[model samples]
Each structure stands twice: as C-alpha cells, then as structure tokens.
Target: MGTHRPRGETARRSRTLSGQIARVLPLLPLAHLDREFDYLIPPEFDEIAKPGVRVRVRFAGRLVDGFLLERVESSDHPGKLGKLDRVVSGEQVLTPEIAELARSVAARYAGTRADVLRLAIPPRHARVEAEERAAPVPIPEVQRDDGAWQRYQHGPAFVAALADGKAPRAVWQALPGEDWTLRLAELAATVVARGQTAVLVVPDARDLQRLAGACTQRVGAVVALAADLGPAVRYRRWLAALRGDAKVVVGTRSSVFAPVSNLGLTAIWDDGDDNHAEQRAPYPHAREVALLRAHESGAACVVAGYARTAEAQALVASGWAHDLVAPRATVRECAPKISAPGDSEQALDRDPNARMARLPHVGFVAARRVLAAGDPVLVQVPRAGYVPGLACASCRTQARCRRCNGPMAVAASQAMVCRWCGVTDPAYRCSACGGQRMRATAVGARRTAEELGRAFPGIQVVFSGGAEVLDAVKPGPKLVVSTVGAEPVALGGYGAALLVDGWTLLGRPDLRAAEEALRRWMAAAALVRPDGEVIVVADPGVPAVQALIRWDPVWHAELQLAERAEVRFPPAVRVAALDGSEEGIVSLLGLAQLPADTEQLGPVPLPASSPDDHEAVRLLLRVPRSAGSALARSLAAAQAARSARKIDAPVRVRIDPIDIG
Candidate 1:
C-alpha cells in the first residue's frame, strides 16, 4: 500500500486543514467563526468529544471559543491537522436530545445552530459547580390536601401521564373565570410528591413572584430563577439546579431550560405573552422550547392561560393533547361582571363623569362599594413612567435624538435622553419642524398615581410599576395604580379592577396585539373578587375588548385564528427567513427558493434602532403549513452555505414570530 500510494494523495494528506472537527459540541449553536482552523484532540478528550463536552480550540487567529460539535476519524485535507488545544471541561454540556432539539429550533427559526444553543443552555459562567453546593436536605412529606387531590382528579389522564417518566405533554385550556393559578399550584404539588422536580414558566416576573409565594407555602424550599436576581445570585441559583440541588424552578421566559433534576412537570402560564419570546439571536420562543424539552425528557407539559393561543388551540383540535376545562357553570359563576365603555352611547364623550375615576359609576362605583365593605381595588395601566415620551400635537412627530433617532425623554434638568441607543442630546430639536413645543399623549403609572391621589382625596393612592413599591401600598381603601406586567395585587384578592386606556394596548402594531392585551386584562381581572366588577375604558365592540366583556376568550381566539388562516400567518402557515442587509438578505431569500403555495411578504422596513442605520434590511418569506419543515431545511442549507462563505453581514431569522409589527 505504501509503494502504491499516489504521491499527490500522500502530499495532500500531509497538509493542514481547517474546519470543525467534532460531530457535536456543548456550546451554543450560533458561535461565530472568524476563520477555519485545525484542532488536536487528545486521547483523553476523545471520549468526551463523542458529542457534547466542552472543548478548547485555537480559532480566529486567537484562542477563541468553539464547541466540540462532533468527532471524525480523519481530516478532509488528508494532511495533519493540529490536535485540540485542550478540553475545557469534562461535563457533557450537550445531550444528544438537546442537540437535536437545538437543531430543530435553529432550522425552524432560520437561526444558526449556535444561536439556538445559546438559548437552550445558559452561559458557562452562569453554570453552578455541583461540588460547591451542599446536598439537598430530605424533608418530611406533607399530607396531600383533600381539596387539591379532588381538583387533580378532575384533570385528564394525560396530566398524570407525566408521572411515568414518559412524554407528559398536554395542552390544557381553562375556561375563563376558573382560578388557574390555584389549580397550577396544586398541579405543581402533585408533580413534586412524585419525587421529581418541576418548572413553572409565567409571562413575567410579577407572576413568578406571586407563584413563588404560593409554591413556598405549598412546598418547602422553592427557588425562584428570574433575571431580577442580580447576576451573582442568579448564577448561584442556576448552578443549584444544574447540580441537581434545587428541585422547584419558577421564573419568566428564560427559565424554560432550568436544570431541575428528574424533571417531572413543565407548566407555562399565559404562554401567549410576547414577553415569552426571546428578542435576541435564534429568537426561540419559551413555549416551543418547553414543548421540545418535555418531548425529549418525558417531562409533563402543561400550557395554561386565561385565553388559549391559536397554536394551543391547534394542538387540541389535532388531538395531540387533552383540553382540561372547568365546568361551564363554574366559569359562569366565578366570572365577574365585565362591561365595556364602547357598549354605552356616551363612551366617546370626554366628560369627566364618563371617566371611571370621576363618575363613581363604573369601576370606581364598584371599588367604592367593595371598600365600603372594606376591600381593595386594582387598576392596570400600560405605561410605567410619568410620561415616557413627548410628541408634537400638531404633527404627531415624536421628539427624537438627531444622532440616534431614538425617542427623547426629558428626565430632570430638562435634559433629553434617547430611551434606546442612549444618545443624550442636551438641545434636542424636532426634525419635522424644528419645533420645541411638545405634549404628552399618554399618561404613565406615575402620573396616573398622582392623578388618582388628587381625585380620591381621602383615600390613599399607591404606585407599583418599574419600581418595587409593593410594600408601600396597603390593600384597603386605596387605589393601587400599576403597570400591566408590574401588577402587584395578590391572587383571589382585589375587590375590583379597572382596565384603562384600551386604545394604547390595542394600538400596537404586532400580530399578537389583541392576544397580549387580553392576557393582561385577564391576569388583572383574575385578581379581582368573584363578585367584583371589571370596568374597561374602551369601546367594548372591539374584538379584544368584547372578549373581555363576555368573558369569551375562546371566541376571540377562534376569530383571530380565522383571520390568521386567511392571511397565512403563524399556526395557520409558517414563515421563516434571514433578515439583514440588502445583499445578504437577497442572498438568503434567493437560497430559500419558496414553494408554489408559499409567499414572500417583504424585504421591507424592519424595526430599526434608527432611520440612519440603513445597513440592515429585513426579508420575510412565508411557507404553507405543509411545507414548513421543508422550508426550514432549505433555510438551514442556506445558512450552512453562508457560513462556509464567511459572509460579514449580520442576518437574523425567526420562525412563527409572535410580533410582526
């Protein structure tokens, strides 16, 4: 063989080659590769690289980051490639299932493998060292409450199917008015009793805080993992779960991958929230990630909210999961009296008496009635600050920074600062007309709080929004003004709730605008007393508003789905493509090669930080539901080709986007 070996072949075999050596790596999927390079793998690291362990490599002309994605027996160059620089850690960072899930998600979202990996796993520094943590103490099991057990019995068999360490996946739709939070807590307890860990994902941190308190009262030693946990503590808690120390995990979107040991149940509260979608790279949604994790680990999956999403509804219609419902009579009884301003002829009148705060005829009247009997009222606002931004009343032109195009806000000293981009312009001038006169269009929580304080003279007015002012606000004889996601009221609690300024929420340009608005309304409404009244300050005729009026979320979702189906939007059809600069986007679009039924919507204006940053443009492609998987594959192929080309332009792709503004 040596004598017969061709000279060219032998010479070629001796040359160094650059490319990813391992078949798999533990690192996130969208890692950038500045240049191709060779890496030597030591014999000790060989077994670890079988596919998931962390490895060190010399990349990009420097010792940069790289995941050992896979292993190969020989190099394509036939020449000698350098051995891996070193193995950073022996721990298997990527499991085969996790890797597959990441790939699927990456393909679906038109994202790079590295991007999906980044979202699935936390940062290396964020991982807790198992050795540093003490073993979890074994506590005496408490007797199950009879009432809770009975409620658990009412859930479908699929709910208990998760106890068997199989795919415990179920899509549950709770009829409006039922106390889902209390039911979810009971489900958490049931899962915990089976000697396994559980993860509960809510729409925001406030919900997490509320659920955390409930879980702590129900089960001992519950750990809350939210971004609010300053870096150090968050890392510590994250490590505890990674090391199998903490069992119960409750948090917002990012907590979907919480590393609870022997994972049993993964429940998502209000999965329809746009907050549940990661706005960064890969753009993987928390709902999809949870479903994938459940499928992979045989963990129980529960998707519950006041209103069901089209995707969830589709799952139920397809018979993939069971729909859990409260008796219709229970929903009818528990649902409070909901009325909309639009239903009344005087809704359009600007009369102060028409205002819920002034007339004491709508929510205010209900609040007074409740308080007369000694109860609290909850008010939900959409914005946080006194006034987030200012605009010209004549032209409706917002004051923006000349350099950044970011909305300018006057924060003390009359100084203008861009809320985004952080461009501070001491002397900001309106570009539209060089006008300085600006008026506040929407009143935020701070201003609303101040207004309520003045209006309700003797009654205390408390504010709860971006700031943690919950402690300053007591429950009785007061108006608790708070932002939507920042609502601080407790469960089974508020005597009455007023949903103000429906226009602000419905006016959003996103596709899920109505869905999100309804979720916020329900979350607040659920907090009110069963006999309480929910007065909404908007035309009740609007679908979103009317849904609240009748407490008929199912109907609203159905109508929304019908509209989506007609337009080929998500849950009806699938859309995917890379969004970037003219050339790169064109290249990506060309590579996508859409099918006959599939359509291309735009290479149009993407949400940009500024009008001046024109280097980036968005391209969108829509695929029929039947061709979605194929389209994803084609997009993935395009990505691989682009990566091989080492293109410089940044491209971002998101599948089934929740926000299409």
Candidate 2:
C-alpha cells in the first residue's frame, strides 16, 4: 500500500523547518474575523515565536498586536504568508487552557474570541510584570472533620467527594444564619488537601473580604483578586494563580477564569447576584463559567446562595448536580421570625393608615420597640436618592421638562431636575395642569431616613447606601435605612428589619423581578438575629412573601423553575436575544441557520428614548437545552461569515441576557 500523509500536510516539506503561527489579531471584533490567522515564522525569531506569547504581526499593511496560539511545521495556505513583526513579550500571559476557554466562551455567546480575550487577560503592564516575585504564603490546613458540614444532609458527602477527587457537582442551599464563608473555606481546604487547587468567586468586594477572612481563619493564606486593589497587587495575585503558586484563589467574577493549576473545585457564592454576570462581550455568568471550567478540568462544582437562581435549579433538575440542603428543623432554628401584614386582610382593615404609609404605624411601633430595647433596626428601601421622581401635586400628573419632555426629579436642595436632559428648573410650571407645586411619587432611602429621624427624635438615623455604602455597622439602637443590595452587616444581627415598599420591588416588568426581590429580601433578612423579627410590608399570600415568611428559598426557586419550564422560558430552555437596527437584526436572523426545533419571537420594536432616535427591534430565539450548543455554534458561524463579507451594521447578539426587557 502507498504511504499517505495526514490531511492538510505539505507534500513538499521545507528543509528549513518552517514554523506556522496562529496569530490572534487585535483588530475589530467582527464575528467573521474572530479566528486565528496562519503566519510564517522567520528563522531568526523561530525560538521566540511560540504559542501563548503576545506578538506584533503585519496585517492589512499595518503592525497590529496579536497572540500566537500555536506553532506547526507546515501550512495548507496556497498564498504567501506574512512573517511575524516581532515578539512583544516572553511571558505567556495567555495560557493554553485560558485561550481555549476564551474561544469556547466566544462561541457560546456568539461573540468574537478577541472580545472574550480582552476580558480574560488585562492589559500588559511591563512595570508590574518585572516586579520581583515573592514566594506564595502557605495556608494552614483545616481539620478533616468539620462540625458545620455535618449539620447538612449531603454536605459531608459533597466534601468527601471533592476531597477524594470524585468531581461531584452540588448546589448548596445556604442556611440563613450559617457562616457560608467558613463553609466555603472548609471546602477549599478539603480540595487543597487532595493536592488540587480551588477557586472561590463571590459577587463583590464585601463578599470577597469575608471569604478571604474565612480562608485565613481556616487556611493560613488566601490569594485575593479584586479590581479595587492597586494594579501591581492585582497583577501579582493574578500571576500567582497563573504560575500555580496560589493553591486557593478567592475573587469576584473575573477570578472564575483564574489559571489555577490542576483545578479541583470551583465555587460561586450568591449565584443569583447580578454582579456575577460579566458586562462585557460574551457576558458569561460566573456560575456558568465555573460549571464549564469544572466540566473541562474535571473539577468539582458548587453553586451556593441563600436564594438560588432558576438556572441553578435547572441543573439540579437534570441530575447534573445534587442539592445540598440543611434539615427543616435546622433552617427554622437559624432563621428569624418573619411576618407579612399585607397577607391578612383583617390586619389591613384594622390599620388602614399602614397600607399606604411608607413606614406603617404598626411597623413604626415595632421599630420604636426594637430601638427602645437597645438594638438596631434595619429598614430596607427600594431607592437611594432623597426623592427620585416627582409629580404635580394638584392633578397627580407626572412632571416633565419642557425642553426634553423627560420626567422631572428632585435634585439636591429641592431643585427640579430633568433626569434625562439634565435641565434644572428652580421655578417651573407643570405642563399637565399648570400647577406650580411638585410632590414626590417615589420615596428613597435619604427621604426615609429624614422622616424616620423626625419620628424618633432621640434615636440616631444612619444612611447606608448610594455613594457611601458601609460594609459593617456598630450594633446600636439606631435606624439604619439602606437601599437593596447595600445593607450593612451589624456586629450582632439587627434586632428587627422592616422591608418597605415591597410592591415597588416585585412589580418590575422584568421576568426575574420577583426572583430578584426575593433574593434581596432574603439577603437583608439574613442579617437579622435569630431572636429578632422581619416584617414585610407586602402581601403574605404572594409566593415571594410566603417564601420569605417560611424562610424557604429552595421552594421559591423550585417554583420559579417550574413556572419557567411551563412557559418555555430560560433555564428550562436556552434563549438568545438579538438587537440592532430593524433591518440589520432581520437580515442576521435570516442569514443565520438555527436548529430544527428553534422557536423565534419578535422583531418587536423597542421603545426609543427620543422621537428623533432610530427605532430598534429585538428578536428572541429559543431552543431545547440539548440543542443549545448546536444553536450557539450555528449563530457564531453565521456571524463569522457575515463579518468575513464586511457586512456590519452593528447588531448586538447576546445569549441568556439577564435583563431581557
């Protein structure tokens, strides 16, 4: 039989041992051009022209930045190849696994690999890179037997599975009063004991700080990665993870891609937190990325949160992961007593003033009692400003600016400011009824504090939100009014919590409004002492309120998952949203090939801010979970093909957008 070489092999081999280069061109992030280009490596620069090294390449008659992905002995290209300009850096900042991950993430979100790489790796800082390397500090080993894990039904098995390198997947339902940071640290230590690395990704810096402290308490040291740190410190921490010097990495969203060598476990805290979602292209959620990394690297996965997301519940439903939850008695013991006055019609009838009052008389009385007992009272508000919106007092009509017709709002010093156009009107007349008087339509944290301060003259009123958010507060008999997601932790848990304007939070147009509201409520409530009380101003009969009253987030999440499945929404299925000029979006959708069972809705016109602005449309495409990968691949291919033809009119394609509205 005649000897045959592998496909794409050159029949006439080069005697010079010519090297092929996979150049990651730093050009416009066009879908069609989102791939590596083949280049010939010159003989002199052959040693430096390797994969994972940044290089300057001559493309389109200009020197552009690029990353060399791979080197080969031959090329299949019929045309003459351009030689690499020069090697930019010897440091392999783009590791092989990360490069592969970037590509995979790009394809998954129908985005260009370059865009994903931009977020994956920060800009190269020569000074930071040249700094002397310090030996990674060793962390103390945690006890093999943990008393906390024993309290949960499947926590011990989950810990054991990870420690034994079984690569188990779990959705940890965090108990209200439990120390999740310590629990997560214990899990990381167990994985480290197996001689494997672990990654813990939280939602923000506050959580990162707490988790880092937990790691220090359990282990000797932890590599914390956060944007708030100086560039030098942040880069050092990142390098530690890349060089495998850091066995345990704790950070926010970006740390999900930390190049920990031999990753054994990846855990995300509060997966439902909007902060976990990457705002850049590809927009990969931290939970999804961790799950993907775990799957690819054979690492165990843990998605833990007080209130789980529907997406996580979907994973448990498919048997892809197990639910690790505490017993009912344990939850009850840890959770505070919860009540909803709106749930009972008799309670509403007995005190009609409490129904519309921001701080109902009953709630005010409860707060006063809690303050009298020398304990802090936490009041959760929905907005942050003094008065976010205003309306005409006489006709109760929304006040708008004459210049832009934008809603008028209260700025500093009771000034009437147009929120949209930034026009200030100290003396303005209402366009609707020619009324000069203006009143607030929505109450904010500052306004709530102002009123509460007057109501309780002797007690102190502390504000905890907006530009000045606090991480921790002293335990005192004070009223701390904070907006959602900005509630500060008390030294000891707050004695009482009042959740005000629950309707404003739950009545949003978004699909996850109730889910998000429940999460916010639970997060605030979790800060209350076990013996304390949480009074919700919403109706008790509502599912979200009931969930809070019963302290059963798992039930709420499961119910949400079921509802989404019935309605063919996300998590139950995969969804992608396309947005752009009406014609551009329509054309892209038409050109793209989708799965056979794909269902599509819209080309629906989206509301424009001004009449002069161009009208944009949105399209939502759905496919079964099994077909998600196929659909993503098809969309990426279509986009790449379109980009290749230079047909770009600026259409945005996002997969599983959190704000579908």
Candidate 3:
C-alpha cells in the first residue's frame, strides 16, 4: 500500500487560513489551460495531496480531475486560490521522471501536457489501487546463445556495456533466421541480472505475447501491460512496475512509460510499423517515446528490427547511436536467397511480365517447389479482404462510388461497395469508358488464397490477415497467404516466400513509399528458412527490392535518410501538419507567423467532412532540424491564442506525422 490516510478528517483549512498551496495540473484538455493552477491544500488532505497523486480541484466552478505536481508554502497568485476538493487516492501514480518526459513530449509535439498525461497514465481503478503492490521477485540466470550477437559488429560490445551497467545506444538490424523475441528476452534478462529494470515495447498484442513468454522463461517475472487486458488488470501490472516489484516490462506502445526504478535499458522492436503511431491527441510514436525515455533515464537503448526506419538511421548518423548490423557475408549466410524481377537476362526472358503479373512464374515455381518439399509456403499480399480496390475492365479506370466519390471495393460475396460509405454499388459503371464490367486491380489476401488454392491442389490454404490473424502456422506442405505485418510464423521457418503486389506499396504517393515497402517486405522475408528462397515481384532496379535481395535494410535506411536530407523531410528536418477547415488553417497559420525558412507544402483539399461542413484541407509546414523546437512552440502559442479567443473552426496540429500521405 501507499501512504496511510487518517481515520477521521482534521479541521478543514481555507486558502487564507493556511498558505499551503498545491500546484495542480487540471485534467482540462484545452490548449489555453495547459499550465498548472495553484490550489489551497487542506490540512486534512495535505499528506495525500503530495506530488504525483491524483486530486480533485474546483476549476471553472466545478470539481475536475487533476494531478498534484507539487506543494509549496506560499503562492504568488494575486487572485484567490481554489482549495483542493479532495485527493482521489493515496497512491502516487505519476513519477517525477515521467512528469518531465510528458512535458518534453508535449513541447516537442506542440500538444498540451494534459493530452500526453492521458496517454501516459491509465484510468484510475479504485479497487486496483486498494490492492497492495506485489513483492519483488528474484531474477533468473538463463544462458543465451551468442551466435546472433557475434553476427553483428557491435552486438557483443552493446551487451558488454549492458553487463557493466553502462548506457549504450544502438540501432540493431536482426539477422534473418534470428529469434528476435528470444534475443530481446535475453537482453532484458541481462539487465535484470544487474538488479536494474528493462522496458521493451512492440507494435501489437501478438508481439507482446511472444516477448512476454520469452522473458518469463528467461527472466524471473515480468509485468506485461497490454491495452486489451482490461483496465483493472493493466493497472495492477502497471502498479507492480511502479512499486519496483517487476524488473522487466514488456508491452505495446503504452508500456514505453512504465515506471520502473533503477532503469537499465529501454528497447523497441520494429520502429517503422504504422501500428507504433498513436492515433490520438499528442500523437506520439512508440519509437520516439522509447528513445526519449531512454535519454531521460540514462539507460541503454536499442531499436532492433528486421528493417530500420529513417529515424533510426538519423540516430546512427548523428553518432547518438552505433549501427549494430551484420557483415555482408554473415547476412548472406543467414538470409534466404531472394530474387526480384529483371535480376538477370534469363529471369527476364523466363518471366518478362513479372513486374505486371500478380503471381509471376518465378513466384509460382518457388511456391510449388516449397510445397513439394513438404514445408509451408508463405505468400505475402499487400492488401487485405477479398479485393481492396476495383477498376473498370475496359479502361482500367479506378472505380469510385458516385454517391461519396470513395474508392470501390469488392466484398467476399463479390458485391461492389464503397470502402468509405459502405454502400453497395450493384449497377456500377465506369466514368471514363462507361463500362459496367469490373476487375480486381489489386488482389487481397483472400483473393490470393482462393487462387493459390486452385493452383496448388490437395494442399490446405491458410489465410492470415484482417480480423482473422493467426499467430503461428504449423509447418507442412500448405499454402499460407497473409497481408504484410500479419504474416504468421511457420515452425522451422517457411520453405519459400513470395512478396506480391510490390508495385502497389512502392507506387504509393507518400514520401515513405520505398522505405515502408522495404520494411514490409523484409519483415515477411525474414521469416523464411536460411536455405529457403524469396521471390519478389517488383523491378530489381528499385532500391527497396535490391535491399531485400541482399538483405541489407541498413543501406536502404541510409539511402532514405540521405534522400530525406536532400529534400528536407522528417529526421533531416521537422514538419508540422495542420489539418482542418481552410479558414481554421489560415487563421492558425497567420497567428503562428512561422519562422523565415518555413516551407509551406500544401493547402490541399481533404474530403468534405460532411455535406453541411466546410471543406477541409491539410497544410504542411517544414523547417530546419535546428528550428523544430521553435516551430513547436510557435504553433502551440498560435493554437492557444485561437483557443483563448474561442474560435469554432478548429485545426488539428501534428508534429512529424508518421504518414504524410
């Protein structure tokens, strides 16, 4: 339990009677009300109103939830101070370390501290708070293989530094055939062995399951805080970490803020996954949060993944972190043999239409060979469902719904429907050619599985994507179709893998197209056996394809970073995206008065929010890396100004948005 509360209330104090003042961060989410307010602390609740505890305070004539940041003997406020209504609970939920981190993140993202706090702290569960914290469990000494460590140039050194209780930051590229979860578990165990805490963050619940299982087997006990594990259960696990009962914590995005004392390491896997980006206020990315937490806590940091992000490359380029990558020989020895379109004249002659074919001859041959070998064949599709998009058969014009102008898609029942509005279009006609016929411009996992099942008869077809995501598939002569990031692990590794619809991902309008495509491809390819083959249905000349062929994601990241620097994009520079009504954006921009070198990318039109609503648009403001902080502050001030004046046309601000498309 926490600090004990008195049985009976003492004499109530007033603002004028006692000078005890509590600086409270009211849970008001308004931009103008982001700062703390001074509240008079009643003598009866003075002990519980200490820093980092939840407290209720009268704000704007009503009691509102707030956190007590600190208490002082006197306040400089000229106006009368409000008294704290009561302390919500005696448990200290927020730590000083996390408080500072929240402030830094808020400033960096041009968001209110209250918004970041909402993301950082879970909702109060009175019953869970009443329960006592768990006792500290002993650490285990599990021996781990050093083979994966020896593959990377600085892997051994990174582990050595961790053992010596020294902070070492590195961006690790996991070699193919490496058990990444087990490797991370071993790393966490090493830090726990030194009586220090380790926090590991992944992208989703399935990943948390794998890492948690591995850590429990290697380390003694770990607190797994997941988003889906009911609020009470999550709070109990979080309290276990906060009370220093668990030395290792493995979870998804929110776990980045785990309050473990004597921190030794902060690590994240797959920094480029879109799932790592939170789609809420403050809009923080898990990789950036993990990095910030590591920096503030002075703990060892590692960004381990099959493919690296441009942001991670920036860390290596700035010398803030070293590159922990395997040598070319080691990569080739561990990675599956990969081939792309136009790799050789013979391949080009054999599969001349490989780039255009959904399932090229090489891919079909590889899948067949793998099936004949009595091993699972993994076919990676880029989209989900039966067909993500449809086009006119006559003119190849993208089919769209007339009602909402949204893209048309085919349901599993073969009904044409609008993806956005969900309205069935039974009598669809092409706007370009006036043809009623439609064809699948892009095949999804289900469509691909249906086709492959026909081609490879007498073999079970397993589908993993959309709502029916399989964690792992049993190894056999079966065809496994999956969407990227949803590829199920095959026991003993896949015999062959086919990355189809490469052009769809590579040709996206987003600047991160190539980088994202490589990340998706490499993530699926790495699941193949060392001796297996990977066939990519993309042009071999593309850098992403070549990188996959050579299993060299580092080169791709470095190239991406250089390109971004040349063009002044994220990591090389900072961009703040303003998305909302045109008037709101214009008003915010005028009020902001951004720096001299700010480059305005767009006031491009976004779809109408509703028939009665104003047309929305997005404007991107770019500045030099050195001006990022200034930009954040300026935008925040402008937002606050608008809020203070009660402007109804609201503009949403996001810093370094993960997807600019």
Candidate 4:
C-alpha cells in the first residue's frame, strides 16, 4: 500500500467538484500501481479535465503525469478524494477506442496498463496537433485484374468483399516475386471506392516505401507512420489518422494501431517477420493486434506472407480466416525452377566437375548461360565475413576464445575474432589437438564472392550485405553475392541463383531455424525469373528443402504446426516467459496463482556472452490455449500483489516471445 499524504484531508476539502475524474498515472508499469485512481475535479479546471486528456496529479506524495480516463458524478470511496493537480493537454490524444484496445492488450499480455498505454500513445506534440490537420482525399481508380492478382483463388473475392462492405478475414500466401504492394494497394482502393478507410501495416521501412508507392499509384497517396520519423512528424501523421484526415495509412508495425476513422480493412504484410513483434512490455505481435482491431472495428482482416507461420495456419484451420493461395498450375508457373542436392543428380552426372566444388559446376554452367543471355545471377550465402566460423584443422574442434569461451572466427589479416565478447587472438592454438592450423567451418559471402570472382574470371562481382545494400540491380552479366535479407532485387529477376550453406542455416539451435531458413531461401528464389533455375546445395531429404523445391510453404507450415502441437509448443498452447533473478521469479510463481493445469519449466541460467556478477534465469509458463486469458489474469494479479507488498525485485514478463529459448 502507498503512503497517504498528511494534507490529503485538507486538500479534498479545498475543492468543490461536480464529479470525480478517473486518472491513471504515467509511471513505470509496477503491477499494483496499474489501476486508475479517483480525483476531485477542481471547479476551475473542470472544463479541461476530461477523459482522454493528459493531466498532472499528486501520487504517492509526488507529482506525476496521467491520462484522464473518464469523469463520473461520484466516487464509491467513504473518504474524500484528492483534487487533480492540473491539466496538461486538453487535446484528447488517447481516443476511447484506443484506450480500450490498450487495456485489452495489457490484460492479454499480463502487462501493466501504463506500459501498454506508453506504447499505444505517442508523446504529446502540441504544436503538431495544433497545426491544420489534413482531411481524407479522394483516390483514383486502380487496375484490378492484370496478372497481378489472378493467381490467387480468393484474390478477387477478397477485394470484392472489402468493396461490398463485408468484413472478410483471410490468410494470403503470396506467390514468389508477386507485387504485395500492388495487391495491398488494390485492396485499399477497393475499400476507398466504397468510401471507407484501410490500415496497412508492414514489417519494415522498405516494405512501407513499396506499399506507399503502390498505394500512391492505385489510391492517390496515403499517410505514412513509423518509429523512425521525428517525434513531431510521427505525431502529425498519427493525428491525421485520428482526425480522419487520412483514409489510408501504410507503415511499419506501429501502424496497426493507427486511428483511421471508419476503418474498413486492416492488412499486415509478412506476419512471420520478426520485425512485427514489439520489443516493449506486453510485446503484442502486429498480426494479432490487427486481428483484434479488425474484430473490434468490424473491419476486414488480411495477413499475407511468402512463408506462413503456424499461428497464421491455425487461423485458417480454425476457419477464423480463409486461406488465399494461388492455384497449383499458377504457383508452378510463377515459381522459379528449384533443384535440391538429390534433384540435381542428372546435372552432376552430366558434369562431374560441378559436384567437386562448393559452388557446384552445374551452378557455374547456369551462371554462364544466364550471363550470355544478359541477366544477373544472385548467390545467397548464410553469413557475411571473410570467415564466420572456424574449427581446428586436425581434430575439427570448434575454435573458441580462451578468455571468453566465445566462438572464434578469422577476421581481416588472419586475426581471430570472438563472435560473442569481441576478444581477439592473433596467435590462436587448438585446445583439443594442440594444432595451430585452422579450417573454415562455414564460408561467408565475402569469401564466396572472392572464390566466384576467380572462377568466373572477368565478369563483375557485386557484393551486397551488411551496410551496403542495393535497392534494385540493373539487368547485366553480373554476379550478385548477398546474404539472406540483403539480397538485391535484379531488374528483370535473376537468371539463376545458388543457395549455398543450407546446413548452416538449418542447424541453428533456435526452434524456428529450419522454418526461417526456408523463408530466406524462398525470398531469394522468388527474385529469380520463372524460367531461371535455383540450385540449392542442401540435402533434398530434409522437409524444409523439399518444401522449397516443391514451392509449397503451406505444406511445410502444416507439418510444423502438427509438430508443435505434438510437443505442446506455442500456437498449439499459449506461453509466457518470465526472466529475472531466481529469487524474484520463484516468489512471483508462488504468488501468481496460475491455472492448475498450467505447466512451468525452468529457472535455468540465460546464455550469456560474458560472465555476470548476478546470474539471470528465465521461467516459462504454458497453459492450454483455452485458458490463456486466465493464465494472464493470474500472473497480473500476482504482479499486483508483489507491487502492493513492495516486493519488486525486477521481473520481466513477455507473452509469446519470439525466441522461446
């Protein structure tokens, strides 16, 4: 319990008010401090102190900022209430819809309302809001059917439903190299044609730029919102949406919460991308947020991705959303020809020399043929460095730094570098075999580019990775060596592609290792023309590789969902991760009063790059999906109890954390 102010009685009697104000203090989300407290509205400040307005109040004997939720005629308290200190902003930044959504998100994630509100509402920019707000502008018509959307079975119907004011939910599996921006623009235009607004949320700024272009082409122009914008600019954009000035908003993750009036549709591009997950407390995912918004606003929902996640599949399976995918023949026609390790037996037999090299001789032949036809070739590598990981030449023991036990790799000038602790060793020796010689365990893009440069002789080698990324490459006889997301888009699509180091990507310890690898491969392969060939140096027997070769992400997602269900992993079951001091976690669990059926795992130390004075461990709590809300409530209750008792020792809670480990 908080301490009562000595002058509280006097302060209450100093003001005569018609109503009490429900205000929530803007403090760090300490559980017990989460609720709203009643304050007597001073007669002079009565007009300004209203719901959704920012106010200052005295809390725990200190002045703090808060948002006024509502004003009521009277309070249920037997004791008199303290008067509101002052009004901060009369402009209602926190709209009723957004406030409710924030509350729901907080409850769902076992997070404090204040923390969720912090993320939901941006900093108050008075100047920006005071400026003349823009109004929704009329949009031009866009071409609907032009080979862009004809591939999907439900593509036309999805657009029609939005235009007809029918709230349709769909899980769209976009074809490789398909124009998602164009597709999203068409949907927005359909909604606009019906005199309604739409909110489109993508994973990153690049996606935002592309979607913005599409929206501009189809629906005139749209308001853009993202974290990278200056505070004033971001707030102005948000205000436009809140004021119904913008009918359509295209942006990154935060755009899901954009207050577009009469929202007819909410779309998320690449829901599987990790960028969609908020890093703040509550950690709401964009896809789930959009779904919630769609349901609340009676708007249509669209979740599209190149590679589907199990969660999205669950939505389709549960009939909550229809699966919008291209027909078999269309997919086969659009997808590049894929050849896995076993599938390339004929090519290897034709050229024995190709099998002897890492790049593969068949890949060389394909490169030559594509270059002759004046098309660039994209080579995808798993890493970007001279040498990413190394091992002892004699015994194959993984090279590690002696000081920090971090995995060691060779940097420029043959100097050994630690991937974890940044330690360096010029004269490193093997611990197991006492051998000084080292071997490359995994080759990186830079090294791969070097090898290819020599093999291909005079042809230009364009390296794209790290900081230097190319937006779009011109059609030429060039070899573009890039790592995963950094792969440059060729002007006319790559003539051929080489997906190397598949084993390195799939062998990561993370749960989504194989799934993510397939996604990366698919993204790169999608850049290749339909007539182009994609040579993957991975065993065809692997499910991920087979899925890639067959161009069936849906099948792979289904298989993954089944596997997760069997193991009781997320999407099958709801999970929460609590990371903190061992003592703090144990205390929290004891007081949490979680569901009886909830399963708890670990107090295991977190994997750290360097030794710490105080060890940090994490606790995982899982319950059946049906009882998810119950679990969250119980945890929240426990947190509140801890805060009330002043027992806070710093515990971090994350719901549906991306990295489960």
Model 3, 478-512: lDDT tens digits are: 99899888999998999999988886676553667
lDDT (Cα, tens digit) per residue for candidate 1, span 1-661: 0011132343334433343355323232433331123355666665655556666655434454556655655444444455666676766566565666766676666666666666656656524444467767553364445453233324645545544445555666565445566667666766777788888998776678778877766665577888777766776777666666666788888788776667788899888887898988778889888887787777778888877788887766667666665556666677787887536557446344453332335655676777686677778888754342466544445565565333556655676765433456777667778777766656577777787777667877777877564633445676888888766654346777888866556545345667778878887787776788888876556788888877777678788888778766778888764567888887765655556777665455444678787566555577778898787667766666676667666577677776543
Best model number under TM-score = 3
> What's the C-alpha lDDT at position 9 in model 3?
50
Q: Candidate 4 lDDT, tens digit per residue, 414-498? A: 7886654445788899987889998765677898899999988999999998878777888889999998888887887899999
Write the residue-wise lDDT of candidate 2 on 184-299 in tens digits: 99999888877888999999998999999888777654699986888778887888787777888999998998877888899999988889889887788888888888888888
Local distance difference test, candidate 1? 0.66
Residue 196 of model 1 has an lDDT of 81
CA lDDT of each prediction against the hidden true structure: 0.66, 0.79, 0.83, 0.79
Q: Between which residue pairs do clashes occur in model 2? A: 31-640, 32-640, 139-220, 140-220, 343-540
Query: Which of the numbered candidates is closest to the native, going by highest lDDT?
Result: 3
- Candidate 2 stretches greater than 4 Å from native: 1-28, 345-349, 352-356, 385-441, 607-612
Tell me the deviation in Å of residue 423 in model 4. Answer: 30
Give model 1's TM-score versus the native structure: 0.79
